[model samples]
Target: MNKKSMSKGIIKDILIVAIGVLAIWIGLQVAFGTQNPFYVVASGSMIPVLQVYDVLIVQGHEPFEDIKVGDVIVFNRPSGQDRVIVHRVASIINDDPKIIRTQGDANPASIPGTDFPITKEEYIGKVAYVIPQIGYVTQILKPPMNYIIIVIVVGIMIVKQISKKKNDKGLNINDLFTKNNSEQTENHFSELDTLEKDKEYSTHVESKPLDEDNSKNNSDKEQK
Candidate 1:
């Protein structure tokens, strides 16, 4: 491929993968019913159980009723505050709004200014899995860096797939060249056959006798 076409292809591939990342991220949000399905623990609030820079994979979009006391949960630090906090549910304060009392593992008491019963709407998800200290790397890959890394990953995935297909099919550049040569040979023979037919038609048309009736009459007159 020419340089221009190759560059276009690379750009197209990167865009496609970037769009895929966005789609998958949206899908995860819908599936988990929370925008913070995977959260990075930014604070030392959850201390011993969860440290700063630890990545937590919030499991399930479980209903509020299923949220139980003693379950380590992730919720908005303040209701609808857009801030997340990972704290252990200390008690079920109310069922009407499904309010729960939560306290950080390291803190002696519940955070001040946070209302008595936290609602289910404030809960993002429960901490089902944790990847310790990876949140630092995850945080670093937040914006522009993440996009670059995703594009690189997409390129690598494409390369791997191509290599795998090549291995599975046992195909090489020689095979491609051989196939092209065979096709060229077939086309050449086809052209030769067409030319031979045209030549035969030309010979047939040229060999036809002109004024056949006159020649026949001359022969008869000569014979008489």
Candidate 2:
């Protein structure tokens, strides 16, 4: 392969992998109808049902009224707090505020006052699916660390691709070995052919001399 061909092949492989990753992320976001649908569970509040580092897929399409008791939901924390929580709906009071109580499956009682019976305005969404263990990847690669890791991985991939292209374009060790072996085999065959031709030519030269001597001796004997 030439330099241009090798580079194009490497680029094609990288693009394929990149597109696949983007497709999965986009498909998940579009299907859930939420821009940020995946959440990492830091605490084991949901216990055996949902372990720590489990990723939650929240879908915003379901109406607040449709949320029934025992259904787990993700909602914004009450009052000045700017955090979200995922818990099971324990009760639903159809009032002006439309109270929706929620509690963790592991907790003995419903989540403390003001947070549980969250209003429709506080509701973020309902838990549509649970992806186990992948949240740990998100948790490990957070913020600056995540960016650094991405840069390092991209750098490594670039270096690998460049090296592969070079190997394909230039005579690498494997190519050198194969080329040398082919030349050596051709040389060996040529040497054998040269030796065989030399032997045949020498035999023809020696037989012609012997035949001439025999013909001369026969002519002399016939004359006597």
Per TM-score, the best of the predicted structures is 1
Model 1 lDDT tens row, 1-224: 89999999999998997787776566555655666566667766555456677766675576768988767777765634756667778888878867789866444345433423578667777775555565566556677766445434433433454567643321221232256478864564344423322232233223442368745765786699
Name the TM-score of candidate 2: 0.54
Off by over 4 Å in 1: 79-82, 138-142, 147-224
Query: Candidate 1: lDDT over CA atoms?
Result: 0.59
- What C-alpha lDDT values do all the predictions have? 0.59, 0.61
The count of residue-pair clashes in candidate 2 stands at: 0
lDDT of 2 at 216: 83
Model 1 — TM-score against the truth? 0.58
Candidates' TM-scores?
0.58, 0.54
Q: Where is model 1 poorest over a 10-residue stretch in terms of lDDT?
A: 168-177
Query: Cα deviation of 61 in candidate 2 (Å)?
Result: 1.5
Residue 116 error, candidate 1, Å: 3.7
